[model samples]
Target: MKKLINKLLVNHSLIYKLFLYIATIILVVYLFPKGGQFKYEFQKGKPWQYENYYAPFDFAIQKTETEIENEKQQITQNSKHFFEYNEEIVERVKNEVTQKSTEVFQNSELSQEEKLDLNTRIATILATIYQYGYIEASSESKIEKAAITLRKGNKIEEIQPYKLFTSSQILNFLNSKIGTQPYTEVQNQLLNILYDAIKPNVSFDEVFTQKTLEENLNKISYTKGLVSENERIILKGDIVEGENLRVLNSIKNEFESQIWSKSNYNWIVFGYTILVALAFLMLFLFLRKYRLDIFENNNKVTFIFFNIILIVLLITIIVKYDAQYVYVAPIVILPLVLKAFFDARLGLFSHVLTVLLLGFIVPNSFEFIFLQIIAGIVTILTISELYKRANLFISVLQITFVYFIAYFAFSIIQEGNASNLNWEKFLYFALNGAATLFVLPLIYIFERLFGLISDESLKELSNTNSKLLRELAEKAPGTFQHSLQVANLAEASANEIHANAMLVRTGALYHDIGKMDNPMYFTENQSTNVNPHNELTPRDSAHIIINHIIKGVELAKKHHLPDRIIDFIRTHHGTSLVYYFYKKEEEYTGEDVDESYFQYPGPIPFSKETAILMMCDAVEAASKSIKEPTAQAFDALVEKIVNKQMEDGQFMNADITFKELQIIKKVLKKKLKNIYHLRIEYPE
Candidate 1:
């Protein structure tokens, strides 16, 4: 049992854990009953109780009656002091007339005869009415008929008035016939015009009847009663008691009968557990291939334990708070933090697996899961290469913008209330963004505890570490100076090629560290002293120089530098033969010597940066031995060496395309030219 427990605990694949978690959450959600207290009254032995509970016909009628009564009162007040001069009404009528007349006249496409005919006809009608003195009489007849129609039982629709007199024509006639006056000509004329305008269509008997008022009042009262009844029903019964106890009890009983008692919850829980377990297993398998370090450090086991605890805590929080769905924003920070500390591929895998797991746990639709994944991916990608805290903050702000856009899009698609933009939503989004900012510190701590080093940490290490430098200074000062020069050249070259400058410099610092074992064997350390290699054969001399690569690897492994620094120590030479010694052997033997012995045992340059370092180291060292170096000589020599290396295919694996190599050659030529400028010989 203990062994089984240990095996399960050590499983690192996120899929396995995800499946387990999903299964557990499914069990919990399935077993747990949904809904809170019911919000309606329960009637015993009533077949139509539910219908009655929602019915609001009486309330609707009451509201309708109240509205009609208000309308009637407004109309009565408006009609008081009939025929009185209303400046607003008269101005409105004049504006309408002027607007209509201008519109008709501005139709220039109409023939002049047509335009004149229309105007003349209107004038003729007005003249005839004025001459007959019928305006005053007609206005009185219209007003009286309108008042009588209102008094009758007929509705406003049934008492149609003066359909032939268009609003524009009435306004035009009123303005032209009745000029502006207080009560003498203008007021009386306007009244006569209004009366004549309305008289032809009035239903005098209907308007004068008392029964019309009674009928309107009855309709209004009936509508008010219906509305009141609905309102009362909405607030009917011991609402608090019924909703809290009886209705709630009925819903609970229904759930118990339909789901719990039927063992549907059990089936759901079982299915969920199986699915979750399967998901976790798949995740474990996926991660195991790339993240073997987790297995080596027992992190897999610890992670499983942590996940279990997290799951339990989350479940507790969910149950206690009755949370509809988890706030998935916090999970987005994890992948970013992981990618910053670990390999990007591993971080991406973890991100995808976690999102899938969360999707299962979350109760929302598939869209929510998709949205969460998108947000997480954006957040992670933004900060994946971050080497500074400021970048993380900037990424957080970017993620905040993405989240708002995504949320708003989701709301729009869901047909949610988007117009109700309130402070709460702003505050919620602000708090979520702020929460992401806070995640950085926590991620930092977690990364450190996990023995993970971010790119920033590696950069910091490059600047501060001086153990190799100090060792070189004490044991091989000459080699130290040579290493410094090589570092300068390599760093510049690496920068030119867009390679890692810090790695190049660090690699240069330690590339010749093996010389500390026998400093006298190297020419750089033999200042004002006997040449050690002069006594030895060229083969033996080349052997000592070639052994440094192997010796450096051994020393670096002992010091426990990372694989990248070790790779530099290994590939810096890239199998190029020691030409001087090979030439000397040829001169001595008067024949070609064995080329294999003269060559440094090398796995050819595997990366662009290492290839650059190899070229720079050779160039910088060879330039030092040139006596009275001129710009032309230096440029020729540098070009010759670079071309030889290129011919030898030393840069084949370095990913240096031909175009980049051409640019590199030009840059080197310029640098060498600057270093070896023309100068006049001084008198000795």
Candidate 2:
């Protein structure tokens, strides 16, 4: 069973597609009978049964009322004993003042003046009650009359009432009575006064009058029963007569019977899915027409595998996110990235197909889908011809502006209000724009790992990494100088042809790397004294000269330079003969030497850039052999060499047409003529 599972899961053959088809058929079978499976539901019934589950209008109204009632009840409960504790504290203080006044007035050891003064103080305290609307008492207020007023006054009615005080005020009042005094004796007297005046109000009859816990619980139960009764009344259904019951049963029976019937709606989804898949496949084919050549080279399998990974990644994104915005990310970035590394028409076609698929997958809203397509089309168009990182950055900025405008357009259409303008929306726009910026570098990395070269790769190749150039300088100075001249000449011609000039220049720099293996055999490194070729036959010298092209290709492969650079090394010499040695052989042998042995391995240039490099290499070498430099001589030399290559079919495989080749030759001639022009004589 495990082995079967592994085969089903891991196999990528046609059997897996068959398994997927069967699984999808089973899923459709199960899902079709489940009503509302893909539709929105507003009510819960059986776990999978369809019912509208929206909150009813009556329920919403009742919910609002219930919340309001709960809030009012909370307020009432909180205020129930809010003032009771404050009343008790005030009564206790009044009683204490009365008892202390009586004790002071009745003391016989006191002088008559002191007794009169105490009596006057008590009278003054009692008189001030009308002015303050409450009896203000102090430590000395203990006369019998004041005690009578406190004991007899009604606790709820006669006490000078104040609103409930907070806990902090009560503690402050108590502390004032015992300031700097031991609190033990003072507390006992205060407790005695509290017991006499307030304890009566707090007894079983007065303080325990509120409802008990059991009573409140019973009330809650009765209230809940009443609410249930109300709900039952509202939702109640009436029994039907015999004929009505038969009609109702007939309707339900029809619904259950039709639940699993064949659906044109499901067919629509399946048909659209198949159409989208075919459209994308066509787009892939259209974009890769040039890829037929690559495919013929036995790399088709790798190419197919790479595209399969891209398709899977796109599909996974659609399934996992299922958001309208998410679909845009892949469609916008993937096509442009494909164009950058592969071909442009394919990118455009892929973008169109991606938009179509997104429309099907997220069928409801067109606003987000339209915005995404616009952003994607603009971004891809902006970066379509980019060949440098700075160009990419500028393109990203342009895309960001387009994205901002697209998002704002969406907001305007969705809300029909300009007030939606705010920093948050701007922030979201900027963040999404930044996300698009991040996608470019990631696409670069993905292409790199797949053995695909992008504009970034060409730019890096153009830059002379100091370390590698230094190695070339130390080991092969003559090859280094030759490479530099070739780079300058090729770069100029490439610019004229509108090819990738950087790639052309960089390829020229390393094209002769293999010449370093036998530096003296090449004329560039030979000293006037050392003539190794003098002892060898002309055929032997020619063979050694042509071997450098093969050797350079081998060294290039070892260093893992991309196929673009490798092609430069192979084709820069084309099938052109080593003319000097060929002439030498003709003179010495007096017989036709096999020209094939003297030619560089003969798969000629395959691109405009390579063809230009080939032209530059020949012209630069021929210029070095010129005894006298002159504008007419330089022009004649360039024209003769290019015309010879054209007649010999060296440019046949290259994409450059005769018109572009002519332009390249003219540009090279003009440059070389200037370089060889005689300096004007200055009057002495």
lDDT of 1 at 298: 45
Best by lDDT: 1
lDDT of 1: 0.59
How do all models score by TM-score? 0.50, 0.62
Compose the digit string of candidate 2's lDDT tens values, residues 232-259: 2211232332322233233333333344
Model 1 spans with C-alpha error above 4 angstroms: 1-325, 334-357, 365-385, 408-453, 473-502, 525-530, 588-596, 626-639, 646-656, 670-684
Worst 10 residues of 1 by lDDT: 147-156
Q: Where does candidate 2 stray beyond 4 Å?
A: 1-166, 169-269, 288-331, 362-365, 384-388, 413-415, 421-425, 439-444, 682-684
